[model samples]
Target: MKKIKLGNSELEVGEISLGCMRMNELSKKDAAEVIENALDCGVDLFDHADIYGGGESEEVFADAIGMNDDVREKMKLQTKCGIRKGFFDFSKDHILESVEGSLRRLKTDYVDTLLLHRPDALMEPEEVAEAFTELKESGKVRYFGVSNQNPMQMELLSKYLKDDLIINQLQLSLVHTPMIDAGFNVNMQNDPAIVRDSNVIEYCRLNDISIQAWSPFQHGMIEGPFIGNEAFPEVNAKLQELAEKKGVTDSAIATAWILRHPAHIQPVVGTMNKGRLQDIVKASDIELSRQEWYELYRAAGNDLP
Candidate 1:
């Protein structure tokens, strides 16, 4: 895997990171194999959430791999908090408690990064800032970021944050191209011209915040990947054509499409299957040209004005 300087942070992370949301469902033996394959593929970053399998994912990860000093030192671990049973909380107490629970579950003293899982409506920037300050000073979290937030939301939080927000996780893929679409259809009188994210991609780029692309292969919201889905024949055909040309799997083509962006979007693939994981990591070595990238975009049901 190729490495990229993650935004303005001091950490250099792999171009592709593994998402361990589903790892809780795997047995120790199966999860161990998955982690081994990821390490072999040079994937050094692992993403998690406090709610993943009710925190069993982190426990399983620690138990499965026996994460000792050597194993923990080899990779970077990141987790998100702030989401609760029926609401979101960014209070200082919740933020501090979340990281403490994560560290205890993962059997680690610190996580390389921590993210606010989602925007909390009642979030007070001052409280978040205080929590982050404590976490940073305590050596519990080295960097901080947010997920599913637009530019203005980020701006509001950054106003009180003492540290640079190193990352902003968002959804981006071939079929789910609203952010990219709004960019292309700017000033046009079309549905795609309606901006949804307040130009978050450009904002993050200007602010030196890396955008982590989650669900890289899914089409629509939780509709599953479009690679072999019969509903997306055109995109599938185009993906297969490019995959054949590049001598890689279609899934790699899908992932490469995200990596080809100039923003240096890092993909967080959540595949537990070792074979599929290896295939997706091939995207790091594949580069799609401008024309090819646009072609895939159009094939995914978008029209250029």
Candidate 2:
């Protein structure tokens, strides 16, 4: 696997990390095998969110891998907070409470990184800063980041945050390229040029924040993956063609398409199947040429000016 620095932090994580979102779906033995497979594949970073499987995902992961220092030293843990049942909460109390709950379920003293799951419109940056201060001083979290946040949103928190925000997790893939679409369609009258995300990619690059690409193969948010879905026949045909040429799984081709970007994005593969996860991790070894990358991009129903 390819290793890259996580933002400005000293932590060097695998370019293709594993997201433990569906880990709760597996039994103890299956979860253990999945975790083992990832580690064996050189994936040291494990991503988790408190709301995944109603917090049972973390519990399953913790049970699968003991929380002792020896095991913890071999891997890095990153989890998210801020999403409540029906609303988003970033208050100091909620942040602290959520982290404590995660610690209890994860059976760890301090997670390597803690991300704000989603932007809370009513968030008080000062309160969050205070909570982060306590967490850092208490050694409960080593780094901080946000998920699904735009440049202005991160700027609001960065203004009051003493710690450097190292990551911004967003949805990105070959078929789903809103961030890329707006860039190329800047002067067009089409809806693709509407600038839904305010050029977050450039903003993140300027600030040196690592972009973590979630759902690298999914065509829509919370929808079926694009690999073999009939809705994306064009993309599937191109992916299969490339997979044959590259001698890797079509899933790896799908992931390598994301890794080819200079943004140095970390693709969070959330597959529970060990074989699928292994195939996806192999993307770190595959390199796509400029022509091939654009070919796959255009195959996904995107156009160039």
In candidate 1, which residue pairs clash?
A: none
Tell me the whole-model lDDT of each prediction, alpha carbons only: 0.94, 0.92
RMSD of 2: 0.8
The residue pairs found clashing in candidate 2 are none
lDDT of 1 at 98: 95
Minimum summed lDDT over a 10-residue window in model 2 is located at: 65-74
For candidate 1, the lDDT comes to 0.94
lDDT by residue (194-282, candidate 2, tens digit) is 89998999999999899999988887888878888998889899999999998999999989998999999999988888888888888
Error of 1 at 71 (Å): 0.9
List candidate 1 stretches off by more than 4 Å.
none
